[model samples]
Target: MKLRSLFAVAALALLVQVSMVAAAPVVRENGAFSCTFYNDGETESWTGTPGNVDWSDAQIASVMRAMDTIAGLFSNEASRKVNVSFVYVNQTIGTAASAVPLMSTESSPPYAPKTKTVWTADDLGGRGVASGSAASVNNLEDVWKYGHYLPSDYADVVVTISSALHLNNSLYYGASASGIQGFQFDMETVILHEMAHPLGFYAPGRSDSKTALEVLTSVKSYAGSIDPKFFDGTTTVAYLQKHGMGILDYPYAAYETNDMASLGVEMSKDGSHISKWVGYKDILMGDMALSGVVRRNYSDLELAMFKDMGWSLANDPFVAVPEPSSVILSLFGLSGLLLRRRRTA
Candidate 1:
């Protein structure tokens, strides 16, 4: 009788352990943002140093904190809760990771009232919609009904990170946390940039060569109803002439000459990517990710661009006073003119 009771207890404990592992979603929350992470069914592997660390859980938690920091940057409460899922892919796409819009309102003819709910999915085609939740549905509709500019949904924004990549773990910085030390490539920076795409910073057309003119032109034409002030104070022609084509044009071809292309020049697809033209070096949304450094914060222009996309924002502490170095760099690209490189989609 005693032996049977012990055996029964052990079996029950084993079953419970299995159940916990199966149902457990590695989740982290900070304020308005919550991120859930999963494996892409690939045998998870991390190369180089830190051989014994659980990279997936640690990286996912780090990513969640990064998302939370981004959320705090904007003062407005997210009308629809933003849930993001990170799936670890074992293969390298190109640079590190890529983001795809799982669902979005059509660009042409626009939606009624000019506000539409957009949804993004994971690499596995999982749209992060909440199951059996009326509040989720109601919140999604509220964003559209009120003509809110930002894409609002209670569903998850699916992001995929490469498990095969050597992500630097030494340097870490995020909205709510910082100074996490590791020697690998900064995973936080890559995750932050990719996640921003589903939030409404996207360019139309293929990934290889979406141009700044294409993005500005599209916004100017289709999004006018949503944001009338998009081009109110800005003149592309003057901007091009003053700043030079390299500032706004990707794959910029002054080739052998100093004269820049016309204002509406075409280059790479927008992908909601900022041109290496304006604030090239420090901003999070630029075209390249350097190893070892983490760009955990967004630039003032990036925040302004979010506002232009129709999302409400909080007062930005970073831009209240202009940094003199940035001002000088903008006035003159003191560094020699360099063409923008393509990043992971």
Candidate 2:
């Protein structure tokens, strides 16, 4: 009887150990960023009610792969902890997936340990906090000036994917980039694009590129919605070195228009994305997202943009393939520039 009882206890212990392993949450790391996840499948933040589905093992794995790709790309070690939560919602076709970076309830702590003057500007060009000490902007602007988020800030960039995306065959949730199907969107690529917004590629674009040029031509300065000096001096100088001093017709980066779309969606353009010129059609940060194209890596120009926004690269910029040649002519091209609008918050 004693021997039989011991066997039963040992079997129970094994079962518990397996359960713990199965229940472990997804966590991925890189230089300064560590992304953790919360699977809020049943509780809908919008409705205050429980949903029918929860995140499956496959879904969690898919999101984890996306984080791995992002973590590998950035090399900064400022120690920013990002919390990603998943929720399912009913969205429209071609709308695909949507994500928003929410500011944490916690107030941002002072910028310290390293003292670099951080510059800030207003929508109307009244640049404030010109340069005295390290401070926290308490907004996405902080991500632009500092390599990491403020110490007191909630260090999280939240994302919400459509339940239909994972449930139906709408997304290709495989690890291979070449495996994406013509009828499906690459889940990893989509998530990567969404993640870029919080990491710093976010600005409502200018009214139009034409308007941007007119302001530069007349005033000989950038008067777009975003400050012309948004990029740090290092990035701007490096861009000029690769391109040329005379090549700047408008702002170095393309601007998007804030417009209303068919789905009652608000389309925010510009500084948030690369220009949708001929060569940039498939660039990760371009305004349009095609169905089957896999834009997984950052282009050289996009890397410079990130560096200007204060993110340190984990590796050299544009170290991977599929990076396009410099967009000297494309930056100023005005024809056939019309592209599909995306809704970002």
Candidate 3:
């Protein structure tokens, strides 16, 4: 009887252990953003939330840390919230990862005026529209003219990450401790890049033209000359002037000149990123992700671009006020502790 009881107890303990291991991972939240990871239910190699494919605890934590870092970059405005659902797709989805902006808002007329007047008659005590011009008295500037007021709302962006590509977590946990290794892609960097896309860093396309102007007018005319407000020459000039560069020369220096080419301020097809002009390498928006090690932080030029996009960095310590060394040291220590625990467990 004693032997039978001991056997039964051992069986129960084993069952409990298996149950604990099978439990789904919990959702993680930081600031105004909440992340829920899901798996496609087909991949045999990955692990995480049950019914969802596998993602190790460390990988999930690293994603959360990436979110924290991005959240720190923006100042709170109008209680806008963002919920990111990170779905692990089985196949490659265009450049390792992609983000779809679920919702976005254009600022009132002062920021995105519908027409430009070639000539105004102040002599007549009232402005007059040029001949054949569609100029109206209701002209409003782009959202940026409002001073750091971009789209702010709950669940503004939804991102999907590819499970097909092997991701490196070392850089996510502080690359110094993980040591440099070749070939593996940095997951955190990818997340940061994808996150920026939803924050108003996107190529203007027909979809925007359709939805933005549909309600206002039935006209479906395609206007290629009207540059994206964020990427226009006006904003670029301001950004260049901030760095003491000549505005006139920026078009040549900052834009690409070949077929399928565009502003060099945008992602470069070659390895050289926009930051190269400013003497930095591996900007977050660079077209290609190179093998071997890469830095986790955005370059000064990248941050300036965000500023030009109308995001206020007044609260971001990385912009002007340097983060205290002690905070960084503490974070490193915590990361090490978590890694050690993960290894031992």
Candidate 4:
């Protein structure tokens, strides 16, 4: 009788462990407890609810294939790797569906204590959503929140598709399969560039402000005839620290052309670190190229950064994402990572 009782207890414990491992929070809007997505199309985000994937197996397979394509980008030629925890959410939700959750109380996060933040412009304030041009939806306000959701911990790369991403004069559509190929790299390149920012790829002296317009102006200026400098450290960093966390924004460790030239990457003829690797034509001083995945599969830099954050890129599962900015500040072997660009040839 004693042996039988022990076996029963062991079985119960195993079952509990399995439930905890596979447990995705049940989303319940009317009840009380729930999970949340920062925006629509966030991987399978649920509120006091669990996701329902009873879709045609074909759709599920396509989504999984898309995920695989994204995962392959981590192994980039530049050796910048990508390590992340996968959070799933729906591409859209009706008014009656439910809101996403966010834990805002922990002085330091990753501890929600059950509280969640819904995906809305009122809170996050258009951090990732695009503005200006015909794609502008700000006038609608609520319509703007329909963009893809980024998780609290964030991912090395965020690939979202939705009705909101129409190529109607929006800055995000330049590289989309629907628009002009940015006259340079494909849409994949831009996606890779954005991913590199959160992963700490640009030079350490990057700006963290919403200077997309400003940078565009500079790029235009340079295109016309002058030497345009769009970003500097203080400008963006100061703003981000004020709004979000400092390390959470850009310039934490940008790996600009100068930063990499010393590593024998061949920057440019002029000593200006204003570009890095644009697409294929100009490897300017400030331009960002393949991280590490501008797409080479994955990058060592990415693996190292993730490892610094206490997670192994190769050994870890896809669901173990750490805080986005947690390990970005870690100083890797300070080799030519900080060298000054010199006019050579």
* Candidate number of the best TM-score: 2
**Any residue pairs clashing in model 2, and if so which?**
75-313, 75-314, 109-152, 205-256, 205-269, 255-270, 256-269, 256-270
Q: Write the per-residue lDDT of candidate 1 for residues 56-108, one digit (tens) a residue.
A: 55566667667766767655545555555556554454557766443333332
Give TM per candidate: 0.54, 0.56, 0.53, 0.24
For candidate 2, the per-residue lDDT at 97 reads: 63
Per-residue CA lDDT of model 2 for 1-345, tens digit only, reads: 999999999999998897654333345564434554444334433223333345666766777777777767655443355445455556666566665554422333332122224444421022233443332222333443233555442334546566576568777777677878787888778888887776655532222222111111111122254332223234433554555432233323433432111011011333455442342233576666787887777666556556544455677653434435435456535333533222221
Compared with the true structure, all predictions reach lDDT values of 0.45, 0.49, 0.46, 0.29
Position 53, candidate 2: lDDT:
43
Model 2, C-alpha of 184: deviation from truth (Å): 1.1
**Model 4 TM:** 0.24
Model 1 scores worst on lDDT over the 10 consecutive residues at 44-53
Please state the error at residue 311 of candidate 2 in Å: 1.6
Ranked by TM-score, the better of candidates 2 and 3 is 2
The residue-by-residue lDDT of candidate 3 on 197-313, one tens digit each, is 655444323322221111111111113322211222333444445655532223332322222222224333221233224323447876566645454666665665555444556
> How close to the true structure is residue 40 of candidate 4, measured as C-alpha lDDT?
23
Q: Point to the candidate with the largest lDDT.
A: 2
Name the candidate, 3 or 4, with the larger TM-score value: 3
